[model samples]
Target: MSLYETVREELLRRVRNGTYACDTLLPSVATLSEEFGVSPITVKRALRDLRAAGVLVTIRGKGAYVKKQVRILRQLDMRMHSLHGTDISLISVTREKISDPSMVSLAPPDQMMLCVRKVISSDGAPFLYDASYLSSNVEDEIVDEFGRNFIVDALRKREIRIVKTEIVVEAFPATGKAAEIFDVPNGFPMLRRNYKMVTTDANITIYGVVQAPFDRLACSIDFPTLAMEI
Candidate 1:
């Protein structure tokens, strides 16, 4: 790696590892230059790249500080934008009977289903927790594959197609597992998105709940322009 790139990555590592907390000032360019054994110009270039990536902000005459987390979620596509520096980890995978009436569409209430939970983090801070219920088939294989990949991707590999999807958004307080994952107060506000995905068989095979700190996630919608009748 180039000198500036190396410097940038090390700085990012520090930020993610909490050496530099959110909204806290990072060491000055001279300090970083001396520590990294590079020139001030190299350090500046590194900091500039980090700032451009939305990871840090430079205040005139004040230096750069880690920015507060804000990940944009494109509601139409249901994907996060600008997630270049995030990590996904599987939390748990288990087989359980479908007790929720709404989930019976996936299978009979008495039948067992697969449950998978995962967490996504940025800057070493956990932001989103996702719990999904899926059809129970090849449960062992699903659990094994999920350790290194997402359940959705594993389902696709098995030729399971999501033909339709519906997402419902709401604000709820964090509690239980979500509260612990986010490390926030029990009553902290959260943005919850519940999704139901129907497969080719017209059965809802995937039902999931994704939650994040209310301020950490933003939703954007774009409308097409139309000519008005004169």
Candidate 2:
């Protein structure tokens, strides 16, 4: 393997084995270079690559640190008719909650109440708390089909397709149960996501809330901005 790859793999192994826990600062570039018997540039490159891959994060003027564990973000492309175009959908749900349940009132509720909560971990370290709620009126069987797999996969089996979604992201101080689930001190910042999924025919809505360590979640949007005439 390439030198950078070798270093990255070792780093990742350390992360997985708890040598470097979440949000833990890493050694200096020079220190790593000396220990790994490589030039500082090689270590820098490896660190850069890992940061870009979401395995590490560099805070300006603060140095590099381990990023919180993240799950594979299932891509929700707006242009795609369905996740796999087979009438199935896939959504991620975790077992974390916000400081306030009133935040859910931001949207109108629909029929049916299918909700699932799960705790997500990285290398066995708890990192994410997610809860997903779906309208219960669509079909009882459809709700029952939400098996142990991804929620979208279950929705697909019922012939319900997610044609569109709206996401709202905000940062807030952790409180009450939210703080405990995230394993953060009181007032520590956490990311709260309010997501809504819409189907093609049933006008159904699926809402979800995800609470996770601020360092663990990263979001990026790629859309062309309108250009103005000079």
Candidate 3:
């Protein structure tokens, strides 16, 4: 490894493993350089790279420090990966006319939809609190299989193909119902995904929100690529 990379890697290791506490100040560049037997300029370059990696921060007058980040954010992908093994506890299921401004596009105003609230947990700890408003055109039997079947899979069983998906991811403090479900303090940082699904026939069939406290899980996405034979 190059000199700067070697320095940055060891510093990264310390920051991650808590040798340097998160949000606490790190050793001065000059001090670290002497300890590592490198010039202060090399150590400064390492610190600069770490800051860009979101692992460290440097206050104007205060020395470098570990950034206090308790969450991991990944890309928001529309594709289904696999069936969830998390225990699904049905919270409530009811038929209601859609009123949410964001959901109105998917859930027709005059037509009623199946509004379902459920919690997904792994090993007894809640990770996702999901609420979905699905077109009542979808059968009742499929709705009944919710806890056991993935929503996308159930839709496929009915020959409904998801042709388009629009998703928005936001990070904010949890409050009220969301905070209660995740069992975290009110105003705790959380990751929320709001998405709408449109079927191949051009019917908007699903409007949903998936929420989880940051400490519970990491997020990621894999997008498909298209290429012509070269």
TM accuracy, model 2: 0.52
Angstrom error of the Cα, residue 117, model 2: value is 1.6
Q: Per-prediction count of colliding residue pairs?
A: 0, 14, 0
Looking at model 2, report the run of 10 residues with the lowest lDDT sum. Answer: 80-89
lDDT of 2 at 83: 26
lDDT of 3 at 10: 96
- Give the clash total for candidate 1: 0
Root-mean-square deviation of Cα positions for candidate 2 versus the true structure, in angstroms: 11.5
Q: Cα deviation in Å at residue 23, candidate 1?
A: 3.5
Q: Please, what is the TM-score per model?
A: 0.58, 0.52, 0.58
Q: Which portions of model 2 miss their true places by more than 4 Å? A: 1-106, 110-112, 144-147, 225-230
Cα lDDT tens digits, model 2, 1-230, are: 99999998998899889998999999999999999999999999998777645577787688888876544343334332332322322343323333336345547463446666656555455555667776554565654455354567676776778888788788787787876775555566677777778886565667777677666655555556977567
TM-score of 1: 0.58
Candidate 1: residue 20 lDDT (0-100): 97
Q: Tens digits of per-residue lDDT for model 1 on 152-174?
A: 57667877777878777777776
Reference-based lDDT, residue 158, model 3: 73
